[model samples]
Target: MHLFDKEKIYGDRLLAVDDRDRNVTYDQLDSFSGELYRKVGGKKLIFILCENTIESLSGYLGCLKTGIVPLMLDSHIHPSLLNGLIREYHPAFLYIPKTCIEKIEDSEVIWQFGGYCLCERNEKMPPALYCELSLLLTTSGSTGSPKLVRQSSWNIDANGKSIACYLEIDANERPITTLPMNYTYGLSVFNSHVLMGCTLLLTTYGVLEPDFWGFARKKRATSLAGVPYTYQILKRIGFMDMDLPDLKTMTQAGGKMPPRLHKEFALYAKRTNRKLIVMYGQTEATARMGYLPADKTLEKCGSMGIAIPGGRFWLENEQGNEIIEPDIPGELVYQGKNVTLGYACCKDDLIKQDEWKGVLHTGDIASRDSEGYYYITGRKKRFIKVSGSRVNLDEVERLLKEQYEGIDFACVGTDDNLTIFMDQLILDGGEEIIEYLYQVTGIGNRTAAVKCVDQIPKNESGKTLYKELETTADNRIQSK
Candidate 1:
């Protein structure tokens, strides 16, 4: 039986609840899934513009129930980017907000409900997808990247079960949404909770919004999940002062939390007798690969903890030999059923089989303690996490160089902050350039900055000196 089969859900349990007080039970959701199945017909692939709403959840669950591969995208995805993906993948159907209907061309709406519409493409031929291909997710969240992680049913099921097992999730737990469902971390929370028949408290309001807390309190939310940025906002807003007696669990993932912030939350969790789980994961692993047990939160403040159920982690040095000594940094490698099939950049790639098997080279450099706890020290890839979304520095430079011809661009910075050094001549266009970066990368001014340099530092080999640029960026941040 499918992992999400209705028979597996607890009988008559509320499946989801929204900020507007709308609720649906498992039976009701199943009925809606049947309706969606009839409308979708033989279509094997769908593009779903996701929101934290009952309609969006229904459509996603329906897709899973009927064996349709759904590529979840941010509901507010830029039009040109979404159109480019539509042209590239040629999805047979689209489940999108009703307001977005005008944005899609040559599509006819077949069904409408709860501010969303299901549209069938006018010119469509179902791509020959691999039988195990269950879902596609953007590699870079909100970056409008066409490259997608190909996840099989086993990947999702294994990861979801592992998360549920480690978190001790039960039917009575209620998890409030704090991140966009399209992101891997958020999707994992959604899928794992649904697996255990928990009432999902859905809201688009962020942690900064007062209404979000009000909704959480009113609904007696049992848990909350967030990224480092979300926890930063929570700390700024005096999360410790809040009186949320019902909230028993909190989870942090999607990027490392600063050491100081991790300590603060760990202390708060300890004082309040609530569980705070620090986790590590990637889209390539479906979702979670490791999670620190809540009991050890304060004891191992900076650690990402041990591997989740059904997963194992080890460190590999430059020579591909496993590191046996503690506190020796190496590329972290994970072996688990959750490891995804591979990536797909186009429709033709969807037919490919599992290229990764059950092992993943995480590209993250980390070390383990004597107690077997893992701590991330650096990243081997030229990527940074901005607001929990992975941003490729090379891709950012390429985009800028392509848009502004003749300008030399070098991008460097730490998590949540990206500095772009450009040719001094474009100093006058800094505002426009930053706005363009936001449009393409979904990185706002708060997280991204532009600095004009006389020339991009390069060596005799003509390769940009990123380390030197990083030092320069560090000095600038410190001076500020």
Candidate 2:
């Protein structure tokens, strides 16, 4: 279902959104979006680079329902990269916070940040609405080029509903939005709340400080949504220390949480008698595919869990055959409505597999337990999970290659550490480079601990030798 119908369906019921301002009701939200739609001329592409705020949400749904495509770029993106994405998307309109408008130039439709601009639309201008609504979100790939994954209303809506059903989010629930609105996981939280008429407390500032928990408790939050690193912060500040009476559940997704932390949270839930749901998903599916039930969290610890409603998942062996046993390792493949239409496909070659049906061939490795719970073993390629954030080894190499004199580099991930071995010549400012990394990756944590490797082993064709690099990583871990 389209997002407009949801606002209509909820009517005057509570849709409290705690954004930049205090709180907004459904009527205010609906009216605000309607006004923005009118100002947007009902459709086209609008680039959002505003801080996470109520205006952002209003603008996002406003563009969606009114037949416009909203191209989302990270608000904190580099100036050069931001300009590149803008040129690539060539959006007809641009809507950011009123404060950011002065920074950008050349747009046929530029809506003021806070105020609604509802000018009449010319029939000759591009149609505001399209039969298929989609978004172009950047996915950091190994190729160094930020690929845009396209998703639709129907795909995302079903995904949201599946999450709501699995997590049991309702009008009484309030989900804290800590991740960027541009990401699928963050967008899913927004969509699920909007679809169920639930509450969402949006904030880019994470719970790094102890006071953040107090704020969440003060809001009487029913739920908290966080990635792996977020759980790490909570664990650090005493996951068991805080007593949240209103907190019925919490969700973990985006990347895998370490088994050790997962168990601690499980015990905390056991003591508090609350639910901790470990989930898994990607941007291509509009966020969320598998989720471990709250009751079965500890029992199914370390697994990304089973597929959500209206979704089918299975694992295949290395030979590309389905693993018949309960303990066999296989690549996770998901078939669901929430799957994206296709990748840009060359631009058109972007979308891959399942031409006739809805299925996503995920590259990660996993195994199923006797109870049907799926546990992530590791990745097939050299991709790393640093602090619950997916970091492509090739992406890091690409960035380093652009700076270094040569184009040779390799990267790898350990159980909890990320290692980047350059040609040794490109290895300066060790700690300063780590600090700079925080700016590049907007993940809500001191996500990765970096180290230097003397040489990056590769074969004749220049393929990274995984066996040798893994040995080096194991030696480093032992040395530590």
Candidate 3:
């Protein structure tokens, strides 16, 4: 069931096409990967700074094929952050773009190909990896953190098969990349499409760029994958009116899409005779855990749908008892082969065996309808008591976004203090927003505050940097 197995791939078919119009075939990809694998010389751990390029992808496949564990990271990560990871993991090798070779102090280039090079660490010792350890991925918001989810080969294989099965992907499918390869959702699309022997349309251009759509049209890309922020950008850029007869499917994951946007896309898909599939997943699940069927997209507008094929979902109350009654919020739980082994906080933790077994207690609070569709209510940790009354921070953000439309709002605070951060341009409206929060959450005017910043901070994946906001909140309180 290995994705790169020669017998499973159509040797002559195009494996990927980059923005430069460079086409790579399956056979050529395998051959190039074999060369990279041999250059490793039995190294067990490597850090791959990933871009949506043939060279980056070849290096990744080579590691998987040869049982060399790789920690995929964004190629454009800050130098200090990258150095921190290098010191923590002590990878024996680094497969990175040629331009980045000068950034490493004690590394020597051992091999080069297609603008990328393999550099061996001169004074580093490779850490011992668990026998089943297949890959390492940073949580979407923790790019600089040493913590990484530990996934197994079986996790990748099972999740890939499940995604392909639900998406109905085949060799004829062409999915244009709209997310970074380091992100779990983006990586899942890559693995599943490759497993199905489909041609991947690789591009560094964003959805806002005209060149991106031009390349998609030229290649007749049949599918598109995006995160919640990507879809928002697409809507702003008039994606519904775009002409692309070849596009038959659109997939969204990475976070909860606003209900309004979700309905809009679902209706657009129905009108255009295309499929809009909404999915739910985490790095802990190796990619995907649930997907709303395309046919039910509009019907289950806000739901994340049922568990993926071969996966099971349930809700557990505070007492750890399974909640069988519908429409009651509880901690969401998932059971499947795709659930990853556990998290690795340091090099020594890499040798640890599976700790979660096959079950993952997703920290999301969700409710299942009578029809068995699951809808995320909020996060367990996202709730705070305002004057002894509980309030959901996510719900506050959602309420503001839904009412304000174009304005961006992020809610973060302690039990009795809720601070809403908005752009400096809307500082005049701060009082109005505070009043609105009081009306909705019943918090007193003194308990709620509004802070205007240059802009809300976000990670590369467009998720809000709540940790940064929390730190700012703490400083503000201390100063007061």
* Tens-digit per-residue lDDT, 172-259, candidate 2: 7887766778767778888887888876776656677655566677778788777765775676676677778888788888777667
User: Each candidate's TM vs. the true structure?
Assistant: 0.82, 0.75, 0.96
Worst 10 residues of 2 by lDDT: 116-125
Tens digits of per-residue lDDT for model 1, 293-329: 9999889987899999999999999899999999898
Q: Give lDDT tens digits, candidate 3, residues 82-195.
A: 889999989988999997876676888888888898898874466898999989999754458999999999999999999999999888999999888888888899899989
Identify the runs in model 3 with alpha carbons over 4 angstroms from their true place.
Answer: 6-9, 140-142, 427-429, 470-480
| Candidate 1 backbone collisions, by pair | none
**C-alpha lDDT of residue 211 in model 3:** 96
Clashes found in each candidate (C-alpha, N, C closer than 3 A): 0, 12, 0
Q: Candidate 1 or 2, higher lDDT?
A: 1
Task: State, as a TM-score between 0 and 1, how close model 1 is to the true structure.
Answer: 0.82
Q: What's the ranking of the predictions by TM-score, best on top?
A: 3, 1, 2
